[model samples]
Target: MSWKGFSLDSATSERRRPGASRVTAVKILIAGGFGAGKTTLVGAISEIPPLTTEAIMTAAGVGVDDTGGVPGKSTTTVAMDFGRITIAEDLILYLFGTPGQNRFWFMWDELARGALGAVVIVDTRRIEDSFAALDFFEHLGLPYLAAVNCFEGAPRYDAEEVRQALAIAGHVPLALFDARSRDSVRQTLIAVAEHALRTLTAGRPRP
Candidate 1:
């Protein structure tokens, strides 16, 4: 077999399967408010079929959950969504989507554990939707990048203004992304990996 034109054969294959792509695993958390398109982004960029655990909204979950921010949003992630993408010979990113509704907030830490980093997808028209994601990353001390998802015909705001409004630090990586595009989602993962690498290498955190 061959991976990216690198053949795996002979003694190498017998021993360790050379050039068939190494098992380099990296966990990345995909988080945002309800209907921010976290699952779509993961599915768009993933090299494998995305695994999603979703549930329908209920009447009891109405007031307890923050529906004000995501009026147009209907469904929500219940357990988690999983996806994968191989960026290079060794850069394989695994995306785990967290629940967006406030009721599922208890699982935040478990979902984020051992993650390389996280991407906080933002709905600029409903910026407050992403507050939980921001708070989770900040409190957990997880290195993360913020990507503003451009909704169709939604009002726009300058990146700087959004950052300031969200109180996101200037040093934290930030950019605009479209969850539906493979290229766009891939870039977001790249940004996340790069940011996490920098933070880990700087000795801020490990594993």
Candidate 2:
């Protein structure tokens, strides 16, 4: 949220290397429900090969996860996925994708520490699945944006309706997104970060 003052610019020529930078890294968590494409979004924009701990699916996972939402996704994020992107020569956004299951919910706060904000992915086909993610963000009081993942058979709802259903302000970012597309994911990231910046700059609410 308060980054340009924190990290290097987008040009990034000053750093010369990935890990070398005068500015501190800006952390951002990408969170959502199981099969919500958290890993996909991370891979889409990562400059490096994403460090994913995905493995082959087992029969035990059947009926446990919504395979219908992720076709050909034999592997899932076990712990977390890490990637980095340079927003500007002055800022670097480091992204961490949380494990995609309710059982892993307890790890969120730890993962979110020092993070600017989050991009909560929602699968409109399974609207109920997104509640946990939204609730987590609201509870953490982090500025976030909801990105509706465009899935097959996903319900068609206007942004306003989704906002009201989620009990979020209309100004909150809720946009149609396809996680597999680099440009789409990048846009979603920008929107959430921008919201966090605005909220940070606005500071505490008035009495």
Candidate 3:
């Protein structure tokens, strides 16, 4: 397949068996507000070593970046986080994590190109921080799900409460997940994948 003039192939040079199924690669985006755990989710679920572009926090961002809720955050994603996971023998997922800071938002359009869907990670402590990401995907008409990153010390709310707080549509899938848990992250990814599939199906012209 081709994305932005770049060709991407999941197959290798070696020959495959007569009955073997060809692998399919799908791109997915992990996006949310600052310090919402987009990077953590990608790293935890990635089968290979995750590629991170984190840079240390500095005085340069004093007034520009907001660190109120997450005072202990010492670094931020300067560009993007990249990872890969093989969901099944014939399916692979390429994860791209967008930088949470607003300054890097210009790159989101490029990162979102050809993406199947997105997972918007929300921190209950600062739920408002996620509104921008939610609005972005909604405006783009992209299929996305909301995942509440269960951070320790943050107040926990039921799915309905979060759904109301975010003002998301009833059809949008919402779930709780721990960014550090591989199993939890995997389930969230599966949910978004299923949601995207359903969305695409609904948009297709009936035969």
Q: Which stretches in model 1 have alpha-carbon errors above 4 Å?
A: 1-18
Lowest summed lDDT window (length 10), candidate 3: 2-11
lDDT of 3 at 155: 88
TM-score for each predicted model, relative to the true structure: 0.86, 0.81, 0.89
lDDT of 2 by residue, 1-207 (tens): 334453323212223356754544567789887778888899989988898867677898777766775575787777898998866555667899988776567778788777777898887766677788788878777778898887666688997787777777776788888898988888888787778777776773211
Would you list the C-alpha lDDT of every candidate in the order shown?
Answer: 0.78, 0.75, 0.85
lDDT for each residue of candidate 3 in 116-204, tens digit (9 for 90 to 100) = 78999999989999999999999888789999999689889999999999999999999899999999999999888778767776773
Q: Quick one: best lDDT, which candidate?
A: 3
Residue pairs of candidate 1 with colliding backbone atoms: none
RMSD of each: 6.0, 4.8, 5.4
Residue 59 error, candidate 1, Å: 2.5
Where does candidate 1 have its weakest 10-residue lDDT segment?
6-15
Q: Write the per-residue lDDT of candidate 1 for residues 92-202, one digit (tens) a residue.
A: 677899988777878888887777789999988678888879987888888899999986866688889889878999889889878898888888888887787678657
lDDT of 2 at 190: 77
